[model samples]
Every structure is written in structure tokens, then in C-alpha cells.
Target: MAESDDASDSILPEPIRSVTPLTGPHPDAEMDVIGWGIFLGLMLLLVPLLPFIIVVWLISKLVEALTPS
Candidate 1:
């Protein structure tokens, strides 16, 4: 038992652990502001692109429908 205990202690010099988790948003106001800004920018950019995409898709469908098969 004593030899086994010494061998285990020698194999590991110290216990490895973390006191805190390394995930999730930081509890900071700046990070929240940046996140909201990025979200809003994405929404604004996508909103304009969506209608143009829809218009182009509708025009293609209209052309396909009008074409004689």
C-alpha cells in the first residue's frame, strides 16, 4: 500500500483543475453592446437582400410559367 501511494504521488506532481468554466459570454457591458450591434447589422443587411432575392425568384418563376412547354 505504501509503495503504491508513493508511485501514484510521484506520477502526478499536483492535481490539475480549473476553478472556473471557460465558456459563456463575459459578464461585461461592452460585450453585450458589441453583440447587439453585430446582430442589428446582420438584420439590416439581410432585410434588403431578402426582397431583392424574392423579386428575382418571382421574375424567374413568372418567366418559366409564361414560356410554352
Candidate 2:
């Protein structure tokens, strides 16, 4: 089992070594833009609603506490 594990580890690095490193704008650039866009969009949409959401959550918690479960 230990020998098999060592063989597998050696083989794994072979594939990694064969792969050419990417050159150019990072492959994640587009994803970064999309992720940031989603984050900013959510912030814009949620910021105004935050107070209302908090108020509703507080009311629910208050009611839950006051009511006999």
C-alpha cells in the first residue's frame, strides 16, 4: 500500500510537469469581472433592503420569544 501510494504521487507530478503554464491575461480575469459585478450588484440591491430585512427579522424574533412554543 505504501509503495502504491508513492507510485501514484510520482505519477501525479508527471502530468503536472507536462502541462504548459498559461501566458496572457489570467484565465480568471473574466471570472473575476463577473464575480465582482455580481457582488456589486447584490450590494446595490441589498443595501437599501437591509434595514427592512433587519426590521422584519427582529419582529419575527420578538414574536417567537413572546409566543408559547
Pick the lDDT winner: 1
- TM-score against native, each model: 0.42, 0.60
The per-prediction CA RMSD against the true structure, in angstroms, equals 7.8, 5.2
Evaluate model 1: give its lDDT.
0.92
Candidate 1 off by > 4 Å: 1-10, 13-26, 55-69
Clash pairs, candidate 1, are none
Cα RMSD for predicted model 1: 7.8
Candidate 2 all-Cα RMSD: 5.2
Q: Give the TM-score of candidate 2.
A: 0.60
For model 2, state the Cα shift of residue 35 in Å: 0.8
On residues 1-69, what C-alpha lDDT tens digit does candidate 1 reach at each position?
999999987895676889987897558898889999999999999998998999999999999999999
For candidate 1, the 10 contiguous residues with the lowest summed lDDT are 8-17
Q: Please provide, for model 2 over 2-52, each residue's C-alpha lDDT reduced to its tens digit, 9 standing for 90 to 100.
A: 999999877744344546777885577888899999999999999999999
